[model samples]
Target: MIPSTTASAAALELASAYQSPSLQSHSHRVFIWAAAYAREHDIAYDAELLFVAAMLHDIGLVPEFDNHTLSFEEAAGHIARVFATGAGWPAARRDRLAEVIVRHMWPEVDATTDPEGHLISRAAALDIAGKNPDDFTPAFRAEVLAKHPRLNLVEEFLTCFKSQATRKPTSSAARAINSNLDSRMLTNPLDAN
Candidate 1:
């Protein structure tokens, strides 16, 4: 059987092809932001794994999906079989991550209690909120702004994502996450997201 890491790597690599360039860049920015949030809160994360996971969280956004909005449940279900057979993730671990992935969507899953879950959930939310340059089509932006008059922070967060999307990852930040694993952050295995 292929090792879990190797399997995950393959899945992530395959996932890249299906993502839009804009979505891909935004995904990276989202992961990095989530990582930053995790660090600030001193949550223990498998940074390398989380980075890869974050990068591919929306792998199910196939070009075929109209509007390209993949539900968390669908994404999780798609990933579970792929990870289980190809990556050999332990059954328990697979179940846990799958639940987290499926419920990662807003109004469905809450990540406030678990550090990693929060990172994944918020990162996806920020992406869906579409505050990025590529994401902001004139009509969509206008609609979104009007629809979410109170979500200024999310709008601001997208602005940051838009600006930073073009920048390279910070060397120090990457290094820090790579080295630290003792964050001891809480993880709710049963939480939906």
Candidate 2:
């Protein structure tokens, strides 16, 4: 159900070029999960925006895009903004895409205010932290996993976050680390099941 657009194609290309295999799969899963949730809830969202944002949400975690000073999310936002501009998006739409990427790291995003942001946040939370495995049925989850395997995502993500936190103590990665994100990742039922 990906929105096929020039912007989305560019996003996918960039993701494949920059992200590791596991990270690339994670990006795809994020998009699929967000789209599924929005569809199930009858939420109206900008599919193209959400798709592009999902493809690049964690881009900054990659060494090529990682910023020494900015948090990974923020760095990714900046990257998406430039990418959107190159794709000929207007300023407001570009900013919205960037905002959605940045907001995915927030604890919560109001659906009324930004449906794409809310969907991405919730979807990423479910995929990464196993916050709501029941949101999707076991059969659906199995199908998704079969299409886009998890690979070495958990260990890889844990390592990335730990490094990010160590380098940027005030980043959201640091906050996640403070909240025992590692334990959550390790003990997530999604992986165990």
Candidate with top lDDT is 2
Which residue pairs of candidate 1 clash?
none
Writing each residue's lDDT as its tens digit, candidate 2 over 40-117 gives: 998999999999999999999999988999999999999999999999999999999999999999999999999999
Cα error, residue 44 of model 1, in Å, equals 1.6
The TM-scores of all predictions, comma-separated, are: 0.53, 0.98
How close is each model in CA RMSD to the real structure?
16.4, 0.7
Lowest-sum lDDT 10-residue window in model 1: 184-193
Best candidate, TM-score: 2
Write model 1 residue lDDT over 1-193, tens digit each, in one string: 1124665466556556665555555555556656655666677766644655565565544334212233433554456545655566767655655555554543334445555566776655544432222322345434433432322333333333333222323322222223331121112111111
